[model samples]
Target: MELLHKFSFRLLPPVTFNFNHTRLASLYLSTRFPVSGPAFSDPGPLFTSRRPLSSSVVSKAGWFLGLGERKKTSLPEIVKAGDPVLHEPAKEVDPGEIGSERIQNIIADMVRVMRMAPGVGLAAPQIGIPLQIIVLEDTTEYISYAPKEEIKAQDRRPFDLLLF
Candidate 1:
């Protein structure tokens, strides 16, 4: 490590933390390497991973973004549990047809319905579209409870309305 640093390479300090979140309270680590200004470009572990909230725990009446709204939004008919179409491979989206109006409309509808389903992701096959397109939701909504620095560094990526 010292040999690399003699040529001006700097190693960032490792994370030190004492987390106490549900299902993740026992971890405690302390580590450091005293190199200051940025050289290496890895911002490691801003947030700790925890077990997901169980559906049974977050029942229908549970907090929905603190609003406590109970009215369920409608979702497009999800492909049923044992549909043959689901087993069949989805068709690969044609690269040339990507920007076409029909494809755009399908993508828009996929995103809109995915939001109402409140899912973080949806594959085209899941909605009975035998195409390879997929849609994903923004992750920022789930990171509100993360640390300020973590949020700032969280790379709030935009959800592509559609992807193949």
Candidate 2:
């Protein structure tokens, strides 16, 4: 329809995908497994060690806090494990719909999820919306506990909610 024509899908490869064939689409995607964190160093010819995740490079803040604890709340489900949509670019939001009830609700839900996850930001594709909307907030939780030197190096102080 009109929406489909308006939004173009950046087909990853094999330029002949038949979207109408749900079975083929699912089968193709099913073969691929998602790896979240950084790549593992090869332990041997046929083995890879996943223990050395590069979180250590994240800085003193990540080492101290350990990627904020998730507390249950009215948060939307975060699409995890690097789904295909995560790699797909989001569409632009229609200007006229910016202040509509649906858009406002989506924004509220996204903000709630970000705070609950204790994450710095959340993008629309993160939640599988596929629209160019992002919500961010700096709670300053890390800055509070970071050493003076670390604080001097990077200042991520609390900031007001941001919507885009």
Candidate 3:
């Protein structure tokens, strides 16, 4: 349970969300959907795209990543617990920069690192990127390894790779 607390969703909105009504919370989010910045408080249109998202812009790797390169490993190291970036609010990603190569690589790297950590979710700042981006996966495989009581207590379930 301590491990789960450490590696659960790292960038949930400050406001509590009621997901009992919809399954969208577990779905993969695409950039084509218009975003309302970091403030999810506004009860307005979040996604306005009318066309299907391009496959190239979306990561095939299935999660988020951070920027910067480390020769020692393919994925960036997870920032330690006391890092300032972890406590500070990260800047929202610029809408125009979503499709850039750098962001794409970051997403890819984040996915790799998250899987390596065997965590359910990760934030960009976890990998040293100060952007308001996050990736999450709650797979059946992960669930199988946990105690039934803990899983029931946490309401954890298998969800697709979710990135935004």
Candidate 4:
């Protein structure tokens, strides 16, 4: 009889970014040792190792900029399993109320709390409101391997609103 143990390895997808010729040239020039005379003058075959090197440079830049990083904590919303808010329809936001400074402040505070709790998503009811507004930060996909700086630079955008 043979004994076996389960094992798995997660592979990260390659990071890619759009860069034009001039930008690539600039990056290559900046990172490589300064050379006198016109640089890249006798440009060797276009198939030189330049492409891979440039890719690595850009990958490092992306990592530094937190382009695809994830947050550190796994703070899911705290709604209890039997909370009624889960089943109840969310309230609609009045158009006039949407742009008020108070509403904006609330949104800001919500973002702060979310960050502190390290939660990915939060509903108004969870925070004691019945409004349809929701703020979420989805960093699950990038959390495991993304650098800290990259995770901090992550951005969030809202989608369509759900109304009761």
Best by lDDT: 3
| Candidate 2 wrong stretches, greater than 4 Å | 1-74, 145-147
Query: What C-alpha lDDT values do all the predictions have?
Result: 0.67, 0.76, 0.80, 0.61
Candidate 1 per-residue lDDT, tens place, 1-164, comes to 77866544334555554455742443322233335635335667655559665454464554455454456655556788788779999898889999999788778778877777766677877878888888876666655656778767866554544354
RMSD of each: 23.3, 24.9, 29.3, 23.3
Clashing pairs in 4: 66-150
List the candidates ranked by lDDT, beginning with the highest: 3, 2, 1, 4
Model 1: residues >4 Å from true position, as ranges?
A: 1-75, 143-162
- Indicate which candidate wins on TM-score: 3
lDDT tens digits by residue: candidate 3, 1-164: 98756555443434464676454454424223445655454757645678666454453434443222224556689999999889888999999998999999999899889999999999999988999999999899999999999999999879999998
Candidate 3 residue pairs that clash:
64-110, 65-106, 65-107, 65-110
After superposition, candidate 3 runs with Cα above 4 Å error: 1-73
Q: Indicate the worst ten consecutive residues by lDDT in candidate 3.
A: 61-70
In model 1, pairs of residues that clash are none
- In the range 22-48, model 2's lDDT, one tens digit per residue, is 878797898665465234333344445
Clashes of 3: 4
**Two-way lDDT contest, 1 vs 4, winner:** 1
Preferred candidate (TM-score higher): 2 or 4: 2
Candidate 4, position 70, lDDT: 48
